[model samples]
Target: MAVRVDLNLSLDGIAMPANQTAENPMGEDWGRLVAAYVGTKTMRERVLRDTTGEGTTGVDDRYAAAYFDGVGAEIMGAAMFGLHSFPDDPDWRGWWGEEPPFGYPVLVLTHQQRRTIDFANGTRFEFLSVSPQEALDQALRLAGGADVRIGGGVGTVRDFLTAGLVDRLHVAVSPIVLGQGTSLWDDLRSFDLGYAVTSELSEAGVNHVTFAR
Candidate 1:
């Protein structure tokens, strides 16, 4: 079982854009940054629940489909779960609506809430305030020997990356340049030194960069 991370980033290495508010939890350029990935046929059927034979069926679709390939459990930050936007709203069940695309256990790391939310489609949100290793421990057990994914909002993924716990990292770098935001490649010079790095340019115009151990 591998510890994996898949994120959409900008060509400038910006994983998240600034100017985030309650109205725009994912930041101003979030949609544009992930436009190519979300436009894939896999995302259309899974996240958007649209299976009308629409959406792009190119190299991006292959990566989109592989995102959920063998992920048994997920670990994410509260921001990725939408808690930063609807912090006071107890009814806010994340941005994934009634049924999230992840059909496994999800560990949400936050210091505020400690509620365990369960969905009918096998997705369970267990809020935990613990270190990355602790969260990974629990998620590994919950994962039942399958691969565990560190789903992110940049900071969370960076934590795991800094700790050297990520077995594989795949970044779908978009073609835009957002000058200000949370940069993903902060403070880690020559991060690719120890890993085998590879790149692929998709027909949708995004570059897929992967660092595998």
Candidate 2:
């Protein structure tokens, strides 16, 4: 099983946009960063649960479809799970709705202890207070030989990338420049030396870049 990561970055390589608040947990420029991905048919139907038959069905949609292709389990950071936004609230489920798109086990890396939450759609949120490798071990077991995804908000992805645990890295480079934010390539100098890389530009101006080992 492979460990994969899919992220949206700006032209400046800002994966996590700045100006974050409780009202907008994803940050102010988040929409612009992921505009192309969210506009795809697969994202509309899958994540948004929109069945209107709308949304683009081009190259961006294909990548969006592949985002959920073989992911058996997910490991994400606290921010990705909305813990940083709603830490005090005991009832805060997550940014995802009642039936999250993930129909598999998901591990949230957070220090704040919480009980495991199971959804009816086979999606289980198990909070973990462990290292990146430890979390990956648990996710691998839960994956049952299927591919494990390193879903991120920034820090989590960097941890896995720094540890050289990721097998596939795909980033949708949106044509926007956010002056301030955490970049995906921060401290990752010469990170592409070992991987075979390819790039394709979508109709929506998103450059889909993939680094595969």
Instruction: Please report the candidate that would top TM-score against the real structure.
Output: 2
- Score every model by TM-score: 0.97, 0.98
lDDT of 1 at 118: 88
Candidate 2 lDDT, 1-213, residue by residue in tens: 999999999999999988888788778999988888899899999999899989999999999999999989999999889888778988778888889899999999999999998889999999989999999999999999999999997899999999999999999998889989999998999999979999999998899999999
lDDT of 1 by residue, 135-171 (tens): 9999999998999999997999999999999999999
- Pull out the clashing pairs in model 2: none
What RMSD does each model have against the real structure?
1.0, 0.8
User: Which candidate ranks first by lDDT, i.e. highest?
Assistant: 2
Q: lDDT per prediction?
A: 0.92, 0.93
Q: RMSD to the native, candidate 2?
A: 0.8
For candidate 1, the TM-score is: 0.97
User: Where does candidate 2 stray beyond 4 Å?
Assistant: none
Task: Provide the clashing-pair count of each candidate structure.
Answer: 0, 0
